[model samples]
Target: MKIVFLIAAMMATGLIDSAVAAPKSSKQRCEIVKKKIRDIESRMRAGYSASQGIRLEQRLRELKKDRYRYCR
Candidate 1:
C-alpha cells in the first residue's frame, strides 16, 4: 500500500513536470506549434462530433495564441 502510494505520487509529479517543460529552442517550439495546428485542422476537416469539435476548437485557439506569441 505504501509503495503504491509513493509510485502514484511520483507519477503525478512527473506528469506535472513534463507538462511544464518547454522546448529547448524557439524554432523547434514554433515548428511543433505549426505541426499541431496542421494536425488539428486536418482533424477538423475529417469531422468531429459537436462536443469534440468544441474542445478541438478551443485547443486550436490556444495553439494559435502560442504561435502568435512565439512564432512571429
Candidate 2:
C-alpha cells in the first residue's frame, strides 16, 4: 500500500538523520572533554600542589583516552 511505503520511507529518513547527527554530537562532546583537560593542565601549571596536580593529570589522561576511543 502507498501508506505502508510512506511509513517505511519516513522511518528510513529518520534513521539517516539520526546517523548524521550522532557524529556531530560525538565530536562536540570530545571537544568539550579536551577543553576540560586543557583547563586542568593549566591549573596544574598554575602552582597547584603536587597531590592535586597528580590527580588532575590522571583525570586528563583518562579524558584523552576516552577522546581517542570515542571521537577518533
Task: Give the candidate number with the greatest lDDT.
Answer: 1
What tens-digit string does per-residue lDDT give for candidate 1 at 1-72?
997885685345331123456889878888978877887888789897998688778878988997998798
List ranges where model 2 is wrong by over 4 Å: 1-24
The positional error of residue 37 in candidate 2, measured at the CA in angstroms, is: 1.3
Q: Please give, for residues 1-72, the per-residue lDDT of candidate 2 as tens digits.
A: 997885685345221122233435777878766666676666667776777567666877887896886678
Let me know the TM-score candidate 2 reaches against the reference structure: 0.58
Cα error of candidate 1 at position 14, Å: 19
- The Cα error of candidate 1 at residue 62, in Å, is 0.2
Rate residue 27 of model 1 by lDDT.
Answer: 86
State each model's CA lDDT, in order: 0.74, 0.63
